[model samples]
Target: MQITVNAQPHEITSNTLDAALIELGFASPAVATAVNGAFVARGKRAETPLAEGDRLEVLAPMQGG
Candidate 1:
């Protein structure tokens, strides 16, 4: 399916958010996810379904002084 990740177009084969993250090389658990402007918790990623043209945002925390 075709989806947008971080404002970029990506073709992925996973149907769920968790699988998609793994397929997209986002295996790190230190990131947060949002689908179509809504936040998806880590425990819910496995149940969160994704569709074509959906917007997925993966954000990683940054450490500052």
Candidate 2:
């Protein structure tokens, strides 16, 4: 399926958010995720379904403040 990841077009095989994160090379549990402008919790990522054309935002914590 085709979806937008971090404002960029990406193709993934997983149907759920968690799996898609792995497929997109974001396996770390520290990252935050939001789908279509809505925040998805870590526990809910496995149940959150993703569809084509959905906007996915992945944010990793930054250091050095």
Candidate 3:
């Protein structure tokens, strides 16, 4: 399916958010996610189903001083 990640379109095979993360090589869900402008919790992404044309925004903590 085709989806947008951070305003960039990407092609993926997984149907769920967890699967998508795995496919993208993310080892953990220590970050927040937004689907089509809606917030998707890390704990809920595993069960959260996604569809085509959906936009996902993944936000992770970054170190700064």
Tens digit of per-residue lDDT, candidate 2, span 1-65: 99999999998999999999999999899999999999999999999999999999999999996
Runs in model 1 lying further than 4 Å from the true structure: none
Better of 1 and 2 by TM-score: 2
Clashes of 2: 0
Tens digits of per-residue lDDT for model 1, 1-65: 99999999999999999999999999999999999999999999999999999999999999998
Candidate 2 at 57: error in angstroms?
A: 0.2
Error of 3 at 15 (Å): 0.1
| Whole-model lDDT values for every prediction | 0.98, 0.97, 0.85
Error of 2 at 25 (Å): 0.3
On the 0 to 100 scale, the lDDT of residue 6 in model 2 is 97
Quality of model 2 by C-alpha lDDT = 0.97
Candidate 1 — what's its lDDT? 0.98
TM-score of 3: 0.89
Assess the local accuracy of residue 11 in candidate 3 as a C-alpha lDDT between 0 and 100.
94
Flag the better candidate by lDDT, 1 or 3.
Answer: 1
